[model samples]
Every structure is written in C-alpha cells, then in structure tokens.
Target: MATHLITGAGSGIGAAVARRLHDRGDELVLVARDAGRARELAERFPGAGTLVADLAEPDRVSWALGHQTVPDRIDSLLHVAGVVDLGRIGELTTKTWHHQLNVNLIAPAELTRLFLPQLRAAKGHVVFVNSGAGLTAHAEWGAYAASKHGLKALADSLRNEEHAAGVRVTSVYPGRTASPMQAKVHSQEGKEYDPARWIDPESVATAILTAIDLPRDAEINDLTVRPGR
Candidate 1:
C-alpha cells in the first residue's frame, strides 16, 4: 500500500479520506489545526499518525511540515484543508480574507513544496480538493472563490512542472458536500438544504483513492464530483 499524507484530517473530507486509505492498508500522516481532534482520529486508525498546527500561520505551518517526518515515503499528498468566508465585497474583513487565502491556498502550496522531494522520490500523486466555487464565482463568495481559484492554478501548474518526473496532480472539485461547514453555512441563513441530498464525503474520498491508485500512465487531471439529482 502507498503512503499518503492528508491535510485537514481532523474531520470532514480529510478525515474520511484518511480512514479510507487506512482501511486499504495505506500508511497515513494526518495533519490538522485541531490537536485534540487530530489525536482522536490518530487513535481511531491503526498505523496512522497526526500533526497539529494552524495552517494559516506561516511559522506554524513551516514548523509542522519541516519538523515532522513522514511515517513512510509519501506516495500521495492530499490537500483537503480549507476555509470559507461568505460576504459581499464590502462586508469582507481583513482577517477573514487573509485567513481564507492562507488556509485555502498558501498552506497547501507550502506543504506541497516541503514534500516535493519525498513525492519525487516516490513518483507520487498530488491531489487538491477544491470546490466548484473555484471555477464559478458567486456574489457573496469572493474570498472563498478567489482562494480556490488560486489553488486550482497552483495544482495545474505543479502538475505541468512535475509531469516529466512521474509526479502527477489531480484537482477534485466537489460541490456542496454534506459537511459540518455546510451545516454552519446553511444554519446561518436559516435555510435548510437537504444534507442527505448533497454529495457524500466518503464518496469523494474514494474518488481520490482511485486517482492515486491508478497506473502512472493514466492521470485524472481534473474531476468534478457533485451530488446527482
């Protein structure tokens, strides 16, 4: 089994992906900002490891990626950590915008760079869990959309640069998944979206596994997995 490193593994899509990979016998390094949650998840999975640090903090992110050794050779890097801020242009706060960009774009890019040697050594795959909002702009989702778009660009550029080295990149755009974040968004507006009708986190995680497990000759460059009506 391959060794995989997943960011944002304390919960949601990241946690689901970690569990799936662990169940398939792949070794995992799960990173998240929440230390307690990270420890809980690490405990749940046998042979899994955890790292806790705030991805938005440059020093913390660097320390987290630099100081910690991968449990094994990393064959896949899954970037699942992100932050979303919904507001009209004027409603956006400086902190909110910064947090959105730092967590959603910068941290993942930094982690990818830090792990480049390991990925190159293993000829691994890099997967970015972006959002449909990255491709299409929404009125109140300026910061969130912008950060995701930046992430998409980074993923594509990295794929092109690493293709000759047998390092592949795949960007998965999942729309409105049933997640706690989504619940928070919906609750804030007092509008209930059918959670069951949204895409399942486990399903998205499975798609990531498929992309990584495929032969080197094949690359699932970009994939959009949304809820089917």
Candidate 2:
C-alpha cells in the first residue's frame, strides 16, 4: 500500500480525495490545523494517522512537525488546504494578503520542503490543489489569485528541481467547486449560494486520483477541472 500525506483533509475536495485513498487501503497521514481537527479526521478515516500543524501560520509548521512522528517515505504529498477572502485591491488589507499567502502558498512550500527527503526516497509525487484563480485573475480576486499564482510557480519550480530524483509534481486547477469555500465566496459576492450549480468535489477527487495513478512511464504535469454544467 502506498503512503500519502495530505493536507486539508477535513472537508471538500480534500476530504473526497482522502476518502478515495482510504477506501483503496492506502496508508494516510492527514494534517490538521489543531488537535481537535486531528481527532476529527482520525475518526473519519479510522487507522489513518494525523498530524497537528496549522497551515495558517506557516512559520510554525516546521517546528510543529519536528515534534511529531513523520513518515520516512510517502508515495505522495498532497497540498490541498487553503483559505480565501475576497476584496478589491484598494480595500484589501495586509492581514488578508498575509493570511491567504501564508496558507495557500508558503505553507505548501514549507510542507513540501519538510517532506522532500521522504518524497525523493520513495520517488513520489507532489500534488497542489490550486484554484482557477491560479490561471486567471478577476475582480476582487487579487489576493487569492496572487497566492495561487505563486503556488503555480512553486509547483513548476519544484517539478524542474525534482525531475532528476524521479519526483513528480502536478498542479490541479479546479474551478468553483461545491464546498464551504464556494459558499463563502458567494456570500462575499452578495449572491445566493447554490451547491448544485458548481462542480462536485468528488469529480475533482477522481481527476486527482487519475493523475496519481498513471503508469510510471508517463506523467501528468497539470490538470484543469471545470464545471460540467
């Protein structure tokens, strides 16, 4: 059974991916923001491991993981945790920018760095669950887009740097998916939230699984998922 260390496993696309992997009998190490969430995920995926590390505060991640039992070789490291708050450039605050950047960009980078040795040892893959914002920026998406754009750059750079080690890197850009985040986005936009109108998290999870499950002779560098409706 391959081992996977995944972030943002509590809900939405992350949860969907985690469920699929768990059902397939893969070993799972889930990262949670706190002890409470760690317990929650542990219960959700019985027998799966949990690590307590807050992605919101990127600086503390290294220290936090240092105190835990990290796996030596994981087949894949999934970066799926993210936070988004929308506001026009003029109204955006430094706090908002920092929070989004820390969670969406810096934390993933840090996690990747911490687990790279394991990834290299296993000839593993790194998957970044980015947003459509990573590809195109729109009004009121300045801060989130900037962070996701940086995430894209991070994945590109990592893929180049790790190719010789047989470590694969992929960035999955998913357009508005039906999740709490989408609901929050709709509320921020003063629009009615409708889950049926968006892409299902399970669909995106399937795409992620497909990328990771490809034969060793090939690699899928990037995937963009859109609403089918």
Candidate 3:
C-alpha cells in the first residue's frame, strides 16, 4: 500500500479524498490542527496516522513536527488544508492577509520542505489543492488570491527543482465546489448557498485521485476542474 500524508482531511474535498483513499486500503497520514482534531480523524479513518500541527501558524510547523514521528516513506504529500478570508485590498487588514498566506502558502511550503527527504526517497508526488482564485483576482478576493497566486509559483518552482530527483508535482485548481468553504464564501457575499449549483466535492476528489494514480511515465502538471453547470 502506498503511504500518503494529507492535510485538510477533516472536511470538504479533503474528507472526500481521504475517504476514497482509505476505502482502497491505502495508508494515510493525516495532518490535523490540534490534539482534539487528531483524535477525531484517527477515529474517523480507524488506523490512519495523525499529526497535529496548526497550519495557520506556519512559523512553528517545524518545531511542531520535530516532536512527532513522520512517516518514514511518504509516497505522496497532499497539501489540502487552506484558509481564506475575503476582503478588498484597501479594506483587508495585515492579520487577514497573514492568516490566509500562512495557511494556504507558507505552511504547505514548510511541510513540503520537511518531507522532501522521504518524498525523494520514494520518488514521490506532491499535490497542491489550489483554487481558481489562484488564477484570477476579483474585487473582494485580493488577499486570498494573492496567497493562492503565490502558491502557483511555489508549485512551479518545486516541480522544476525536483524533476531531476524523479519527484513529481501537480497543482489542481478547482472552481467553487459544494463545500463548507463554499458555504462560508456565499455567506460572505450575502448570497443564497445552493449546494447543487456547485461542483461536487466527490468530483474534485476523483480528479485528484486520477492525477496521482497515473503511470510513472506521465506526469500531470496542472489540472483545472471547473463546474459542469
């Protein structure tokens, strides 16, 4: 069974992907934000490993992981955990920008750096579950979009840097999906939230698994999953 380390396994697309992988008998190392959440995910997956590290506090990730036991062989590192607080450039505070950037970008970079040794050993894959906001900036998405845009740059640079080591990197950009995050976004926009109007989380999970399950001969560099509607 292939071993994978995944963040954001608690809900939304992360939960969907984790369930799919777990049902297939793959080994999972899930990253939870706290001891309580770790216990919750551990019970949910029933044999999956859990690591507790607050992605919102990127600066302390290294010290947090130093005290834990990371998987010795990580076949894939899934950067799925993210945070977003939407606001225009003129209205957004430094705290808002810092929170989004720390969780969505810096934390992933730090996790990837920490796990590179195992990833290189296994010639592994790193998947970044990015957003459509990563591609385009809108009126109220300045800070969040900036972080995601920076994430694209990070993934691109990592792909080039690790190609020689036989490691693969992929960035998945999904349009607004029917997730808790989507509900929050809709509330922020003062709009009605309709789950059916958006792409299913399961569909995004399928897209992710498809890319990672590809043969060693081919690598999917970027995948954009838009809503069919």
Candidate 4:
C-alpha cells in the first residue's frame, strides 16, 4: 500500500480525503492542528498515524514535521491545510495577509521542500487543494485570492522543476464547497448557507484520489471542480 501524508486531516476536505484513502487500504500520516481530533481519526483508522501542528506558525510547523515518524519514502503528499480570511484591499491588514499567506502558501512550500527526498525516491505525486479564488480575484477576497494565486504559481513552478526527478504536482481548484469555511463565507456575505449550491467535499476528495491513481507515465497537471448550479 502506498503511504500518503495529509495536512489538515481533522475535518472538511482533508478528513474526507483521509477517509477515502483509508477505505482504499492506503497507509496514512494525518496532520492536523487539533491533537484531539487527530487522535479521534487515528482511533477510527487504526492503521493511520497522526501529527499535530498549526500550519499558520512556520516554526511550529517545522518542528512538528521534523519530529514526526514517517516512512523514508512517501508515495504522496497532499496539501489540504488552508485558511479563508476574506477582506478587500482597503480593509486588509498586514497581519491578516501574512497569516493567510503563511498558512496557505508558505507552509506547504516548506513541507514540500522537507519531503523532497522521500518524494524523489518514491517518484510520488504532490496534490495542492486550491480554490477558484486562486484563478480569479473577487471583490472582497483580496487576501485569500492573493494567497491562492501564489499557491497556483508554487504548484506550477514545482511541476516544472521536479518533472525530471519523476515528481508530479497537481493543483485541484475546487469552487465554493459545502464546508465550514464556505459557511463562514456565507455568513460574511449575510446570506443563508445553501449546501445545494456548493460542491461536496467527498466529490473533491474523489477527484484527488483519481489524480493520484493515474498511471505513473501520465500526470494530471490541474483539475478544477465546480458546482453544477
């Protein structure tokens, strides 16, 4: 079974992906900021290991990944951790921008750099859970949009730099999903949250798994999922 490391594995899309992978009998290294949640998931999936770290803090993120006991060669690294802090440029602050950028972009870049050896050895795939915000800027989503755009750039650069080493990078751009983060977005918009208007996290997880399951010779550079209505 291939070993996969997943960040933000406690809830939302991350948790869904972990569940899907577990059901497929793949080994998992689940990382989340909440120790309790991570432990609960580990209990549910007896074969999975857990790592607790807040991706917003770079030093703490480094420490957690540094100390975690993972296999020497990981078959996949799924970057599912992220934050959605919405604000227009006029209302945005340095702290808010930095916090979002650190968690959404910098942390994943660091983790990818740290795991390069194992990824190279296994010729593994790197999946970035990006958003539609990464593609186009919205009126009040300046900070979030900026970070996601940078994340897209990061994935593009990694794909180009690592192709010769047999490392594949895929960016999954999921439109507004029925997630806690999306609920918060709807709250900010002063609108009732409608699950029917959003994509399901499990559906996105299935897309990710499909990308991972592709033949080694072929790679899906990008996959975008959007709500039907």
Best by lDDT: 2
Q: Would you give me the overall lDDT of model 3? A: 0.95
**Candidate 4 RMSD computed on C-alpha atoms after optimal superposition onto the true structure:** 1.3
* Tens digits of lDDT, candidate 1, 1-229: 7788888776789879987878778888887677787778778887687777688884577766567655548889999988776889898899999999999998888888888999998999999999999899988889999999999999999999998888999999998888887887777567977789888898898888888878767899999998885
lDDT of 2 by residue, 70-89 (tens): 88779999999899999999
Clashes of each: 0, 0, 0, 0
TM-score of 3: 0.99
- The 10-residue segment of model 4 with minimum total lDDT is 62-71
Candidate 1's C-alpha runs over 4 A off are none
Q: What lDDT, from 0 to 1, does candidate 2 have?
A: 0.96
What TM-score fits each model?
A: 0.94, 0.99, 0.99, 0.96
lDDT of 4 by residue, 6-115 (tens): 98777789889999999989999987777787778789788898877778886577778677675687999999988887777998899999899999999899889888
Question: Would you list the clashing residue pairs of candidate 1?
Answer: none
- Tell me the lDDT of candidate 1: 0.85
Which is the winner by lDDT between candidate 1 and candidate 3? Answer: 3
RMSD of each: 1.5, 0.5, 0.5, 1.3
Task: Give the range of the ten consecutive residues with the poorest summed lDDT in model 1.
Answer: 63-72
